[model samples]
Target: MTSQPSLAKADSNPSSPGEPQSGGTGDTGDGLKAGLKNRHLSMIAIGGVIGAGLFVGSSSGIAAAGPAILISYALVGTMVVLVMRMLGEMAAARPTSGSFSTYADQALGRWAGFSIGWLYWFFWVVVLAVEATAGAVILNGWIPAVPQWGWALIVMVVLTATNLVSVGSYGEFEFWFAGIKVVAIGGFVVIGLLAVFGLLPGSDNPGAGFAHLTDAGGFMPKGAGAILTGVLMVVFSFMGSEIVTLAAGESEDPQRAVTKATNSVIWRIGVFYLGSILVVITLLPWNDKSITEHGSYVAALNSIGIPHAGQVMNVIVLTAVLSCLNSGLYTASRMAFSLGQRGDAPKAFARTNERGVPRAAILGSVVFGFVAVWFNYQWKDTVFDFLLNSSGAVALFVWLMICFTQLRMRGIILREEPEKLVVKMWLFPYLTWVTIAMISFVLVYMLTDETGRKQVLLSLLAAAFVVVFSVVREKVRPRVDA
Candidate 1:
């Protein structure tokens, strides 16, 4: 059997200033170029967590938990912050496009690395199809001339071309894409807060106040059990927050960029997820039919007498769908490239074009993404359902792995490279264990619900397939001398 790589020494040294960090494993210069600028990194970090889910999915949580839904957001947000903190600690020490997967290989084993890496790549690729389909639906609504499938193809082709052109092109597109989302959400928060405090003109909803939080159903109207259930509803929205850490490896100063992103997690969650939801519930009663009927954000805007609020939000949702598509394509490809570099995938995937983009890797991910889209249309009931359910719980699994990886990675850094510990996990070993237990509880809790049980079981089956493939590949492949 092939031996596991050592976490302590896996690209532990930082690259010299002003040079592109090697993208391949073990200091090899055969990888992506560091063409992304600081502004691009900053915006991607800010916008990475703001997905279409937040805009569209919050209504369900509000309907389920009432004003107490804030507790669910805070609980899940705290878990995300802790997870990102652990990731930031290792990423700052040894920045890599592989992100946590590389750390897993070093700390756990080749089996762990191969399985989690492929699982993550699969997750993003499926997300590509989901986001592409969503964007196509919105575009088709605007322009009836093109069919939904045609629009999906067009969106995929355009983003795939952007990724192929160069890493900078991807960064430039994401910066603006994320910029619009940040502005829209920020504006929503400001306007919603005004409406809540009676500061906005022509805005006087009698129910729009903090009193709505306690008066309506008296907080935890459905009982405290629903708060834990609410976690199942909102936790998936936090999946994309780790993209910044992955993008950091290709930046001019990976450590600095990662440190900045890690430090900002508190406010990002505070203002964006928790803060925005707080305004929404405050502006409209938790039980307001419009909150679920017209959607939470649109309902809040409508309550303030904003003209064309639905149309405005539709445009923003389309932007979010496209942004997710763009980022998903980039993420899946880079992960494929990382897998190749680590010898867990075909070596050709490690090759870069003149523009320093992993052409093969990008195309490879898109190919599967296109396939998934086709399945959505051709076999929506059978094949697509399985694909969707199989990947449903991967985010939770990835978080679980991150928690485990951080526990071992922290000790390795302390013993071998203390100076590189620029970003540390909070209350190491203690909070780390707490995070692990929390994740475990969520997984167990999922088994009780019918839908959640199907998702978790199917995801486990997919993970098992990858683990078996990894083990078999290790056994049959030719051995290399240490």
Candidate 2:
């Protein structure tokens, strides 16, 4: 836990207990610490963008929309880029440890910030449960000595200790976890291109032709409806990308970190996601039997000349799972710590150790994480399904708030600090509103579907639960007089 000066500014005092400590480049002493470096921030910005969802779920998009699934990814990725740009603009200017949550408090209101903070925390903690199970399952497959649940417990405990050491330890761990995924995807793209170009072991198929794409019902298996239908799933793949901005708040150079990350997102969406998926569809038939069973990328590789396809993908998927767990722990614990500082959660969460990491917050998140692991393996059919189905819809809520905060923060910056406009959201107000409307429509649609009904219900219950707690806390002690 190598400590540095608190980044809080003079006017920005320690966040009142249970409130987000305004990370004003001036915070100090046991409250908040700077243990992460520029490289960690940069890699987190880059590596965290590619999530396990892309590794595991995008194949469904491919099957549902076929070749045109690429279009769905493009559409969603574009929106994510625009929304993140808006977030980066505000985050670069203020650069608080709270990230979007703090911005919501300032731009929206204290209540809004509190609600979103807890919701985001809840969302990631759910992910921690899901991801930890995923990592454990892979381990169980190889070393059958430990039952799957046992592997899950081992994973959660190890990561908890890693996070306890220092924020940098988590960063270093994530850097490599993310690095492996990057390498795997990068390798996939290269091999995919080689296969497509008639350069691989089996050169029977021609390179870059339309047959694989258009042959099976012309690239829209279920028609335009399916392309749109796949959006729900495709959009989920982009969820973890925003984690970098959340994490940037703690880095050595907050503003610069935000700018670099925001700028790099365009390429990540392009190359890692769009570019790679494009290669996947182009290399193999959209309706290939391997896809539905073996996963799109590994199946594609297997269809080609690659050996050990399943094990290779297993390694990549495991890396992705670990990366998600690593980032999830970091994101959730910070939100808890931020909430504690803001007076919304227990004050102990805000208590930082000598390394400046929030020890209690990390452990608290891990506790539920282990519980989630239990639910996953024990209640595989019922509890885990409910957890996965119910919580994913909330990601839109968090992204929407980020958009809202940026909309208001734009004016705040223009009036007070023009310099921070270093990273601007393209088409500002117009595109911003479009993304919001689209997000709103998705949420509304979630309520209409029969299967989606429960998801929407649980999601609203969660959000409303968080909002109510925030309001009650405010009533208990009005900050104006406190």
Candidate 3:
């Protein structure tokens, strides 16, 4: 491993000794303003994990694992909670827009930082196209006059402009976008719970009770093997949960925000993911045709006699797609800004305008986003499929890196600065090792599954390319010591 870089010392007394100085290499001074408020940060943290995946992807998990899909969610949710705890530990010590990328640099090396940072940025930029197309499909269905591609273009442009305006604009837009999702999911859970207890006024589905969990093949309908398969299906839904730590870098109090979001992961996962899935299976049998014919959420809503259930879900799902696109652009650009500040990317990407927005970084990501959309329209079956497959396992790769990075970072903090250890990972080395083992197990499991094998192989190919580029760049440029 490369020797860890020395942290830049603050001229003013730091709240904690581990806190980085404002002029450090990690500090861009690109003029990113702390405009995100506590409310915005709180909602972003709450709604970040509630993606379109939960609404749409849960059906497959339910089908694959039967009622035991709840177990899959709980397992993945535990992994995420552990991963985020480690991240929170580092982020609270020295918050930066670079996030885990910066932490990787301090704990591992430039190679780790550059490779992981660019890979993550690439992941989100591709997500922009995926999400915009998703939202556009729904809009085009509503107003048939607009072409699907045209709607995609419109959605991208609007969100791009919102991000370019300022960090606060992105925060405000996400605040309301996520608000709608929170309300929809919360309402669904409440109604479903009521129906489960026979409290709904006109509900008539006799299967809407706790007994449905066992009535449909007795919990492990497909056997214990299917639970692992369900993990692959639902694990990616948790990708955006780390975005709150990233956004916290731009908030009024970075430490407090990171700690709050980190500490709250348990309840968020319990209530939002596990709670919703339990309610879903309770409302309808796992094998019911409607669960797949209409999405799990829609079927659950329909079970309780909600009018226009499909249409209502379409609106919420569309909102989720837009929210993902908005957050994706923000995340990718901020990462680009961090790379530039750290000398891994072109300096132009680090430049911000009067609004403290990285216009070049945002535009750069949007350019690739547009290109990906074009590929989707032209060569979706081949080129687009490759792109999609290659990035599929990036979330796992990132989580693995976080675990390794935290292992080293924890030691460094203890030796050099302990006071900054405000948000600690549970059980230190033991739980950290357990998280690593679980992640490795998932990767090995993916190798056994055909589709998953293809994705992991292709994603490794992409990661290898970035690693080579980072090594060559470091050799040629050789970072000057701070």
Candidate 4:
């Protein structure tokens, strides 16, 4: 066995905020360029809050909790805000492409970093397959000449090439893709609200009014407990909210970008998530048969007399899917690049090309993504089901780790360099602990339901295997000074 490296040395203070640390800047470490502009980061942060899940997966939540699903969304939104605050606090102190994983190395241990890093990478690659397939289905519907799998292949290849070219290319594509989503949803909410207030022009369904919120069985139709069930249903939709923090590392000003994204999270969640969902439940009754038949958004549009509502919503949903696929490839590659830098992954993943793009890492991630796409096509129910379930709970795991890491990192920052603490978590250790408890409760709650139970068990199993591998790898690998 190789000698073990001192975790204490790994825990040493990060470099000056301006200087590139192990995982920061394009100097003396990974050659990733600062290609993302302020506008790109702005749109990415705004777009991060809206996911295809909100567009596609919300029907089930409305079906389950009725109008009370609003509470579930608010609860999850609050949790995300708190978690992002903690992450922002750290990222601002010492900006790095590694983001939370690097913080995990400093505050927890190498094993923690290794485990979470790989799990996060696994989650996104799987998501690439999911988003690619989703986009393909929509494209195939629009153009029946191409097979679904052919569309999937074409989408994956195109996005992978965009990422391979430069981080800026990814940002440019996302800027437009996300722009469409933001505009589409924003317009929906405005039109829906106007119709609800009986102010819409040429509208047949005026006075949608607030009655739908309480009329049919009074909000908590399934009972207050259903709110928690709704939480499980809608929680995963919030997955991409943290991608901005990861993307911030590649921007011109990492700390400023991190702080800005962190600060604006609340409003983004409010306007996009809570605001849009409110429009849906209000514009039509939560229990309306059409809500489930045609989806919440489309049903709302149809109620407002919008022609071709299904087709319009499909166009928007397809944009959201493509955006997700683009971001997923970028996120997975960066995480792999970080792991490679720390000697946790193959060294080739750490190398970059002339344009400062992590070509090897991007290709590596896409290769697995392609294999996953194949699995999706070949044995969707058995193999792809396991992949989906095992990666399902990772968002919760990631949030839990952020909460824990913040608790430790706070004191570390104070002891070493207090000024670096620009973005503070509200209520200090108290709110941090509360956030941790809330996440743990959600995990435990997942056990009681059939679908949630499978996701929790399989995700836990996947986590356990990674943790064990990390520990064993630490023992065998040669110890090197940080």
Off by over 4 Å in 1: 1-4, 7-28, 479-482
Q: In candidate 4, what residue range of length 10 has the lowest lDDT sum?
A: 11-20
- Cα lDDT of model 2 by residue, 1-482, tens digit: 11111223211545343445424453433266666688888788888778888978978888878899988888788878888888888878877667888778767777887889888887888899888878887899999999887888888788888999988899899989888888888888887888787777664446765457787778787788776667777887788877877677667778888899888899988989987888878878888878888888887777676778889888889888888888899889988887777666777887776567788999998888778777877787898777776676788888899998788778777766786678888887998999999888777866666666677788887788878887887778765313
Candidate 3 lDDT over residue span 1-482, tens digit each: 67876544211222112333244333334357787889999999999999999998999899999998888999999999999999999888878888999889878998999999999998998788889889989999999899999999999999999999989899999999999998988888888898998987798655456999999789999999999999999999999999998898888888999999999989988989998999889988899999999989999888888999999999999999999999999999999888877777777786766566778999999999999999999999899899999999999999999999999988878777789889999998999999999999999999999999999999999999999988887878867333
lDDT of 1 by residue, 271-311 (tens): 99998999888987899999989999999888888889998
User: Model 2: what TM-score?
Assistant: 0.92
Native-referenced Cα lDDT, model 1: 0.86
lDDT agreement of model 3 with the native: 0.88
The estimated TM-scores of all candidates read: 0.95, 0.92, 0.95, 0.95
Overall local distance difference test of candidate 2: 0.79
Cα shift from native, residue 396, model 1 (Å): 0.8
| Global lDDT scores for all candidate models | 0.86, 0.79, 0.88, 0.88
For 152-244, candidate 4 gives per-residue lDDT tens digits of: 999999999999998999999999999999899889889888999999998878575899899889989999999999999999999988888
The candidate scoring highest on TM-score is 3
Error of 2 at 65 (Å): 1.1
Which residue pairs does candidate 4 place in steric collision? Answer: none
